[model samples]
Target: MFKSLWLQTAYSRDPYPALDQDVTCDICIIGGGLAGIANAYYLAKEGKDVILVEKDTILAGATGNSTGKLTAQHDFVYAKLLKQFGLDQAKLYYGVNEQAIEFARSFAKEGEIKAADSILYSQTKHGTELLRHEMRAYETLGIPGELGKNSELPIHIDATLTMPNESQIHPVRFGQHLAQLAVEAGARIYEHSDVVLMDLKKRLLAMKSGHEIQFTELILCTHYPIEALRGLQVMKLAVDRSYIVAAEGNMPLQGQYISVDSPKRSIRTAQFDDKTFFLLSGESHTAGAESNTEVHYKRLNTDVQELYHLDTLTNRWSAQDPQTPDLIPYAGIISSSMPYVYLSTGNRKWGLSNSLANARIISDLIVGRDNNASQLYAPDRTGFGSFLLQALKISGLVVTEFTGGHLTRTNAPICTHMGCRTRWNEGDETWDCPCHGSRFRKDGSVLEGPATKPLNLK
Candidate 1:
């Protein structure tokens, strides 16, 4: 297993104290990634007695492994959105992301580092055509972009779409900074607070350490919605894991770049302290679905050699992305079962922008302010026939994995969340669920969840 470059090198600070006693708050935010921290920043700024908890540490989730591109361009998604939904809905998505960029800029005075144009390049003719469609979508959305044939990449591309003035930051530095701001602004933060379950009747969350937190409101931002309530089962989320390699200095990009083709590749560069490194991330596959996980990293290393001729690879890591069927996030009142409870998940690898957008919408809803962005991302969007098909497909996979659990003779552990058979990820040396995306460490301890408990290795 490879350690994340950001986690290993970007930033460090003293850990926050864990919850030692029972406490009550106006709101409780779960998960310590960008989404949860952003919510804490907003709510605490309003002087609400908010408490934030993390199972591990801040940016210890996907945000730490993120590419850190703060662009609205989510790899040729707008064209598909424009086709499926109307121009208005597609435009709304862009508007929300742009708003997120501006919101991120507000903290620029503290830790913002680099701002550059984001370019999405395509290698195939078909992919180039999609770029043109994306250009039209950009025009409709009033987003400044242009489809062209040039790029800063070392590889040849048929076309490129550029979103000007997008930004990237050191996610760890930025996350810790926002957390400090929240702490200074009157929010309480607790680390290593693993929530095992919730008492719906008492409106309290029970921690694994035998402590309880009472809350009038809840916001679950765990990457996989471990707090899955009544309406969560029917939701179809495609969990994908992508790899990243931060190699020692080679050909570096001045701007962010990703391919529109399958087996996607995203290229960006970062400077940590006095040293700079090129971060190449891609080779995405469904969690626990890889025939051999090591091949993904091998392919990435080969691609780097072919593109940049950089033989010095420094670090490698993987992150899971909870993707919604429609490519939009679920970030509002989760369901009718809990109308006042708010949450965010299924960010489709665009977590940075979507996280901010979600935080803004959730904050506005809590403050009882008029919010135009809430309806577009409503979590209860299940009336579509297309979405039904997606749900059925995912449910079929879950059943197959469940059956495999009972039939298989291997010693590999079963997912604690749903008793699904797990596949060993050679690249990360972890057990990943093909069913619902729960992941476990080599010793069967939970890494990412939807699984509150660890596997029974005995």
Candidate 2:
């Protein structure tokens, strides 16, 4: 049930070797997810020598688990962005995402990424009002979209905002293709090369295999920045996990769609091994908030059975997303103090487009090109008034979780990131930290970070 559809049909290649010796490069990238590969692709295209290291194989993180929806219509976010970041920044957000989608179209093979319209619908009156506001924002921003009452979805929807020319792709295949293109452009990629130590000031990193890399520039594209540096990203960003279940059914939805209402439902279609399947996803909660995460899968399965009547469940999986207080990603420089270090994260759940956009932003900054979107996602940007309050609320929750975690009586180990007690997630069978969203394997190895070191079970 926990198998990811994309990973199941993943592009296969012989595993890249771990870093076997010390190396020096013009740029060194951490993490091998879509963001890392995309960064390598663009940076290498500029003829910059790059080395990318991943603890696991490429795309094994959020990219492999993603639904691969590449669209700028991110679940009625335009209205909120307009209200918060103002019109220009909001427009820039949509523009960059659109550019990222076009990049995907240009880069992907014929069938790897397919064109599809994207839709955001709502079932309740409040949701309808939200969509209306979003429609206004779209119009004001010169985004092409229209209001509708119906779609190819089986469930009833009160209103929908449709944006044409969006696309969806096989995340694993596209990432592998990017990796291949990057390698062709003279980029080096290594798998199972866990970065165990780093001296950012010296711009040197040591991997688990004892080999060290020296570079003039460092880019961290890990789902969560493994190194908090001085940015305090652990306090500014919150981690969310969403579940997806793929059912074997010939019936397909017309376009990629998501609901603006509570208990969000995202719908898309996929073809694997000549069999058509539909992906039903939603039920987002904080990473470690739910102990028995299996209930989420059960709820998703129930929704699929009732809505699509697909009983043959093929696969179920979940992806972790880092969310910022202002809802915009932190994609550029980590901090002013560390000028050569860059990190991209907090894409919410729309990493497919945001990752590519962030990679572009970072590559442009490294190559000394002018990118208007850089300030929009700068990690060091101060939060707005409301976002400051939201950030404080998140910090308060972290404090509560930290206090409550220590008071509880359990055999659970403490999280290495912030010492919060870890919770066992039944669905994924990982130890998850409620405080900062760190995850660990059953054998006490780090699965996700903010927590760079493994749990000490002893």
Candidate 3:
């Protein structure tokens, strides 16, 4: 299961009982993260008999490990989107993100910051200029923001872009709250129920426990949508893993700060046990690309010390998010192969806002209602240029890794997704796929996946 600062800070509860008998429901939601919980809330509120199943416990994956920032300011992403997709697309993306924050605020904890401004500061001249361009995009989209020099920071900032009315929440607390709220609304939740196979025609979900769930509808809100079937999600997604270190320090900063330069350093403060913490997160790379992922954590610690003068490092954790070729999250029908199945994934480190929006879009689709957000987030939408670029990059890596493994590997663990050789993640003690971000424990048990099965240990 997943554990992080949020989970450590929040108390753990007994696992929900595994589904021991057959369950027939109006809707069966898979995955226990933000999207599943949110979907459960919406469906349960509509008075549907919703049965949500989790492979692990609730808040035991990305949601438990996240640095929650409910913001549309996705690291100057609007600037690029504005230039590439035009004003209308950018505005819609921004509006949907804001709408998510509004949804969270309605149920978020008292300490959570609702509509707090998010700031992105640049240390270099080139990055500063990029921030300026981003500020212009913000204005064009009618997004409230300001451009200035933030001198109050422990570090120097040449230029900064402030995104007005963003928000933050304690991720675990919020997730737990949602799960409880959903249950109170008559939703049934089951933990330790890993789905091994899905038969679309039969409308049956076969579990690892040998129990079956029959549902009229299914939603794969799992962080990495479980591909018991060959959905070919590997081609559509790229995984980016980033490190996070949470520590209590003497220095405290104001608004949320994200860097506009490489080796991203996103800074935000959180309060736990009456002490505020400086959560420094950055150093992202494709999962398993680095031979020694631990170095990234050490680098972040040193950077935090040098920049914030923080000497105490309490917690160290990592989380992975996926990117689609077009840079837009996929939220709609899972695939034509399984038209009855729907999913919401590829949060790309912005699950806080995107998951809620995706949940809304999926909930509406299940009810067969016209969702205004459907067009932009269609799972089948293709950007040929982006698709080709991603395909070429991924193909190169897969070919090289497999080709090299053939010469030296005698039974080294191989990725189950497409048979690419797995690389050891030194820090996490898991094998990770460079091709598609599938992860396995040293014993070959699946940790995360597009590959639903464990690696053959022979």
Candidate 4:
């Protein structure tokens, strides 16, 4: 069942090797997930020599564990974006995501990626209202969309929003395809090579294996930047954790969906060798905040069974995406403080769309071109109320971790990538888990699950 759901599933192939000895390139991207691979593809296509380094396999990070929903409807995000940043800013955000949908369709047609069925829905009254607001926002921006009242499923929903051309794909397969194409286009990809430090002054990347590569420019595409340079990405962004369950179904689910309420739930389906599999995801909380993720899994399993009459969970996984307080991604020059460095992050759960959009933005910035999307996604764009709220949330977590009983003394104190205190992960160890709920060892070996890899100490 695991093999059918994950092992033999569409996105499992590996990519070519990295340079065995020190090498140089026009740009060195630090992660091989969606953002890095996509960036490499575009940059290489532009005739720039690119090198991508992955600590593990391509898509092995959050991209591999994604639910694979490729839509711009990021759950009542437009309304918030419009309110927090002005309408002009919100429209820019919407336009970028819309381009992402088109990019996915084009990629699928080119056989770089395959399209899966997708359905949009408003699972709550609030969500239904948000749908109306979103439609008005889209109309004002001159975008096209259709309102869906009834879904193909037997279950009832408050309202549905269908983007007919939107799609889903095996992210791993898509990532690997891009990796190969990038290499064929003259970009190099390396795996199992972890970058430890960046010598900005020397314009070189130092690897944990004691190798250094010099580059004219650098892209910090790692899930989070490993080396703490000038930009405060840790303070500017927060990590959110979401779960997914892949289960065998007697029948196929009509399309992909997402819920608007807290602890959101999303639904979608894929067919493999004549058997239908449903992918259900949601229950987002700040990463390591939940005490028991298994409970969340059980609840999702129960919901699927109750709603779809399906039994037997096949595969389960979780992903962590960076959430910016402003509800937009960060893509462009890293900061005015650093000239040669660039970054792309704060994707929230919309990495499928934002990753590609970011590629275009990053490419523009690297080549000294003007890009409105790049300005919209700039890391320094600020002055939103959401920033204050995010600060409060992070502060609360810090206070709770220090004084709350959830934290148990352990041999190796756990450390969150965002610097929150980790509680004793009794069930797993590798430091107890909470915050985003990822468990790590005293030396950082992932024990429980969900986390695709151990903490990136280097």
Candidate 5:
């Protein structure tokens, strides 16, 4: 369940129910967040019968908790993308995200949804040098951006890079609108319909309430897929948890800002009624395995107080995002063995951008349209350096959980989704809920619940 403050806010006011009865559709989407809804929206428009099932309500996942920064700028990612995957692949990645942003902007513009909020993009003093490097990379790709020493912000930073076309919006509202659009386009959405078992061989999904859905094609849009298919998604993608605090202030933070430093803080503003609010987000760490989430919250509050003299802490929430080893999202058909099953995950924290882009590419693949973005985001594609690095990191974490001090003395035993023992969290007292905060009690009752149910003890 979400915290008290967030639950009381505007975003949490509406809730959708889960799938209760057996049904069939042309496409079954598991997960009601942006990716699932956007995919459904497009597919339904194309006259495909789609059914979207969500464990909880729509946008109840990270989408609701997102800062909703809709931008192609993915935190100094271009340079790394160019170096690791080549310039062509990097350009495709950027182009897809940019197109996604444009899609959102157009959707808002056409009054198909509410207006997307625009935000001035700027970076901190620490990121100035990185921005210069990024600008050069962009120039190499013939993309235009600018450097700025001044901004609309009250706080002072050495220099910043502004991307004028970037935007933001209330993600929950956007999701609701997309859901309505999907339904109007002949797609059915089932909430509270948790998929407990997936029979890949039979192409069947077993819901928690004993209902089953059969589909010719399946899309695992659920932040984390329950079924461990080929390539071991649980091990391939690492989970990161981040925190945010929203409060009313003297004057709101003028732009969307991301830090270059670790525990990367993000600053932005929103308006509620006649009051302007500042949202401070950061305090990121590995999910369910963090040392001091409360301390991080306090630090965020402290930063807000020191920076803006705002004291009314209105809302606070946490989100978990799947981070790939190389920082690019894995999108497309899972593999040849599961050709009918498509997956979109490992978006890091850029869900707003990547989710839309994923929908476009995945839809294109499903419809048999030629799309270069699909090839760029393929799951099975791998290279030497990235493969070795992923192997080393996942193996090291597995080893440490077994041999290290973190897991040995935990009050409750820890375990990863792949059945590996996890490190215990003393503070949270819920097994540190490793493998993306799917927490359980000492007796194995769900507590945190990103994981629909408790670990299967073998």
Candidate 6:
């Protein structure tokens, strides 16, 4: 039940070996998901010496478990972005994401990419108002979109905003293809190479397997930065977990659909093994905030059975996304002082397009090309009032977590990222940190970070 539908595909690849000895490269990418793979693809093609390392198999992380919707219509975001970033920047944001979709089309294999209109519908009055505002933003931005009163979905709706030129893809398969292209272009990729320590001053990465990587440039695409940077990154980002389930059904929608109302729903369909599976996803919560995570899956199951009468569930999985204070990603050089280090994080659950955008921004910076988005997504961009409010909210969460962590008298080990106590997640069977979203397996090895060290369980 916890399997990912994308990982169930017949796509396969031979495992890359771990680093056997100390090595050196011009650039080292610290994760093997879409961002890292895409970055390596661009850089290596331009003749840069690149090496990518992953703690697990390629696409076995959030990329593999993603819902795979590739579109610029990130649910009612245009209106908010228009207000926050102004007209020109808002237009650029939409343009870059659209270009990202085209980037995938450039190399996508047949059947791996599918054309679909992305529809955002609303069942409530407030949601309908949001759609109306978003449609105006779309027009102002010169994006191709339309507002309507109806959709193909079985559920009732007050209004629908349909955006054309959107797409969906088998994300894992496409990522695997990107990895192959990167390797063919002279990028080295390694699997099972868990980086447990980093020496920023020495430009060295130490692996748990006792091998080391020395690099001139480094990119951390590990979803969360391995280092807290004095809690600056953690302060600007919050981790969200969302559940997804694939059920046996006919294709119910010609385009992907998401709701703007409460209990937001995301719907899309895929064809594989001569069968169509409807992927239903929603019920997002902050990671480690819920004690019994199984309830989320159960709720989705109940809703699907009631709505579509889809009694057979084929696969279920969940993914954690790093959300930013301003909803824009943190990309490009980490700081003006440390120009050699780059990072891309905080996609806020829209990684498919954002990942490519990050790759382009970072690659352009490294190759000395002018990119307008560099300023838009810089890691140090701050001082907006709304962004400050969101950052303060995350800070409040941190303080509350610290106070609660000490009050809870349990034998559970403290999180290595911060001192927050670990909470057992029954659905995923991992110990999750509420403060900074580090996860560990039952035996207490690091499953995800900002926590590099395994639990000090005796």
RMSD of each: 1.6, 1.2, 2.1, 3.7, 3.4, 1.4
Model 5 lDDT tens row, 280-327: 888888776665567877898998888778898888777778887777
Off by over 4 Å in 2: none
TM-score for every candidate vs. truth? 0.96, 0.98, 0.94, 0.88, 0.89, 0.97
**RMSD to native, candidate 4:** 3.7
Task: Indicate whether candidate 3 or candidate 4 has the larger lDDT.
Answer: 3
Error of 1 at 455 (Å): 1.5
lDDT tens digits, residue span 130-227, model 2? 88888899999999999887588878889988998799989999899999999999999999888988898788998888889999999999876776
Model 2 clash pairs are none
Q: Write the per-residue lDDT of candidate 6 for residues 65-96, one digit (tens) a residue.
A: 89999888888898888988999999999989
Better of 1 and 3 by TM-score: 1
Residue runs of model 3 more than 4 Å from their true location after superposition? 1-3, 112-115, 228-231, 336-338, 408-411, 456-458
Please report the TM-score between candidate 4 and the true structure.
0.88
Q: Model 6, stretches more than 4 Å misplaced? A: none
Candidate 1 local distance difference test against the native: 0.84
How many clashing pairs in candidate 6? 0
Ranking by TM-score: 2, 6, 1, 3, 5, 4
Q: Cα lDDT of model 4 overall? A: 0.70
User: Per lDDT, what order, best first?
Assistant: 2, 6, 1, 3, 5, 4
Q: Which stretches of candidate 4 lie over 4 Å from their true place?
A: 1-15, 109-120, 399-407, 416-421, 424-443, 446-458
Task: Summing lDDT over every window of 10 consecutive residues in candidate 1, give the lowest-scoring window.
Answer: 226-235
Summarize candidate 1's per-residue lDDT along 170-193 as a digit string, tens digits: 777877888899999999999999
Specify the poorest-scoring 10-residue window by lDDT in model 3: 225-234
Candidate number that wins on TM-score, 2 or 4 = 2
Q: lDDT by residue for model 3 over 240-292, one digit each (tens)?
A: 89989987876555578899888689988887567888888998998767769
- Candidate with more favorable, higher lDDT: 3 or 6: 6
RMSD of 1: 1.6
